[model samples]
Target: METLYDSIRDKTRVFERTGVASFSETENGVQVLTDNGKRVEGSILVGADGISSTIRLPAKYRALVGTSRNQFVENPKLPFLARGHMHNVYYEGISGFCVQGVQGLVFWCLFFKEEAWPDPRPASKFTDADCESVITKYGHLRLGTHYTFSDLWQSRVNASMTVMEEGMIEAPWNRGRVVLLGDSVHKLLPLLRRSVSQLPSREELAEAFARYEAKQRPRANICISMSNLAMRFETQDSWWLRLARRLVPSIPEGAWMPFFVEYITSAPRLDFLARESPVGRAHDLKSR
Candidate 1:
């Protein structure tokens, strides 16, 4: 992230420890107000903020929300969980593990169904005993060969419980000069790590946003549907789905190669870029 920040430092002006209070469109440009009473103006405003985006509220009146609340299952932590690599492990809906700042210190999270918990309380509302009760209930499950849910829970430097909300705002990704990007426009299940690709370049800001939505909406819908399906298959105790899950692991790896290859090859691509041959020349050999 530092490397990325450094690379863009020349072209980017970053405002740290700042909160956006409001935004408006003016004849000159888009204007943003910070909580500190400072105002900034630019030709266009892009909201790259995450799921709880303030910019998204104006785009859609409502969003389609989904959630996965299930019993525990374990997998190896993300490879980047080790020192010098920054990332986290999210195993389906049951738990997410991360190592931050301090080396070898891992954090785990568990989310409960709204019906089961009933109270819409913040993480601070839960006590250590409350967290322990949850761990005792599901900690017997395996996370990896080396660690059970309990093993990680017991070794945790810290722990928290929270709710996960997933959804996509309805169309109209932009309202006048304020456009949306990243989780602000589309929020998918955690199963898929990648976000929508970079917005294609266009001379007009509205045209750029239009092309971005056109390119991303279809792929986002596909991912959302698949992620929902996966959650249901993994979390629901339905007989057929459970049976299929049991059999899936035992199947040989190469059996799904054709389907995997097709899915990858058919993935959406930005249409504006010229196709390139293996040698790096434009395949059509046409000048832009």
Candidate 2:
């Protein structure tokens, strides 16, 4: 942003916009909402104000979304937990992890303990002090198994993990003049870990998005549910916890490449779609 702003700062054509005031449709086009009732008429409106947008939408819709409510706190007892390594602790059917990021920074998850936050915020709001308290309270704090707060890059924080599904706002992603994009269409759970950008052309993006939602919705939901279940099983803090951790390799990936390829494409080579499969006619294609 800084780089782009600097490069375009001198250009009169490049200007910043603020305060959406109002808009109306006309025979020619539509007018944009602006401060002091200013107008910048255009042919279209793109609602990109996030999942729970503040703007009044005509074709309003919703997608099932899951959120993780996190908070940060200081952990003076064990400072090293702020380093970049994973510390997964389990108790009963609940599971969670204390992982570190940059210097003095830790990211955490508690899939078991439930809290309510229908309106989610960016995860960065959580602090280091908040993280330590949560870990010390819920986690079966192993005194010396891994790095603790004392080894913190800066200080310790206790972060909360409150996961919830948005059940009320669920609907098909489109209506009429208003269509949804991003979270408004299909709200992904944390760690699906990818973003879909606006396609180059408007028509191109709309068509592509329609296809994407149809194919990807079921699979994405399954991944999120399975992840939660897996976390629960892994974090059992009973005498069984130790045994489970030992038997499982560190960081087992629950992914199948061949299965995914087959699901999305007709065949590995897509040759059948091309009139002939290379598997049966490799030599014929090579000779040609």
Candidate 3:
């Protein structure tokens, strides 16, 4: 994340610690008013304010997530940590995944089913005690054969708890010079990305936004459906789910090669950027 931020830092001007109060379209561009009484001018506004953006929706699940200190280096008794590999488990009504990130920094998330909030809003901040409470409830759960969830919790450097909202805003994503982005439009358990740009007139900007929405909405819908299906398979108590979960462990690594090949072949590329040659099996399949 730091590397990605640094790559764009020279080309982008970022403003932090301020909230958008309001915005208005101008003859030339757009004017934005910040909560701190600052005015900014831009060709367009992209609201990437996450799930709690303009239209608020209730959350069906609350998750605890955190990054652990380099456990491989810190705890010699632990098993070898493999970078980029994820360890996941699905138990009835409780499911999570833990991964050893770059430099043996462990990252994880545990999702707990919760009653939906009546009003849409940001999740209340959690204290250290709140994290401890979660650990106390599910600490015994094992990640793989070697380490339990508690093992990861004890070495935590930072942690957070957030309500996970799931839905899409069906309203028009853009009005005049401003457009909605990210979780503001579609809040899915899976990740998706989109991009936009500047245009001369309000009509042109609106057209661009419409085109962006048209191209991206179908992808978001498919991802959200997949997420919901996964959640049901992981957390629901159906007999079919039990059988499916039991069958997962026996599935061979080669069985998943086709899915990976399809994912790579279907991946979206930036049309404005110069094209790069595809490689490996995806390229072979495309050549056919």
Ranking by TM-score: 3, 1, 2
**CA lDDT, candidate 3, residue 109:** 83
Steric clash pairs (candidate 1): 74-143
lDDT by candidate, in order shown: 0.52, 0.43, 0.70
lDDT of 3: 0.70
The Cα RMSD of model 3 versus the native structure comes to 6.1
Give one digit per residue, the lDDT tens place, for model 1 in 10-37: 5547777688899987775778999999
| Least accurate 10 contiguous residues by lDDT in model 3 | 188-197
lDDT of 3 at 30: 91
Best by TM-score: 3
- Local error of candidate 2 at 27, Å? 4.9
Report the number of the highest-lDDT candidate: 3
Instruction: Please identify model 3 stretches exceeding 4 Å from their true place.
Output: 1-14, 50-58, 62-89, 97-109, 116-127, 142-148, 155-166, 187-199, 237-243, 246-260, 271-285
| Candidate 3 backbone clash number | 0
Error of 2 at 52 (Å): 10
Clashes of each: 1, 43, 0
Pairs clashing within candidate 3: none
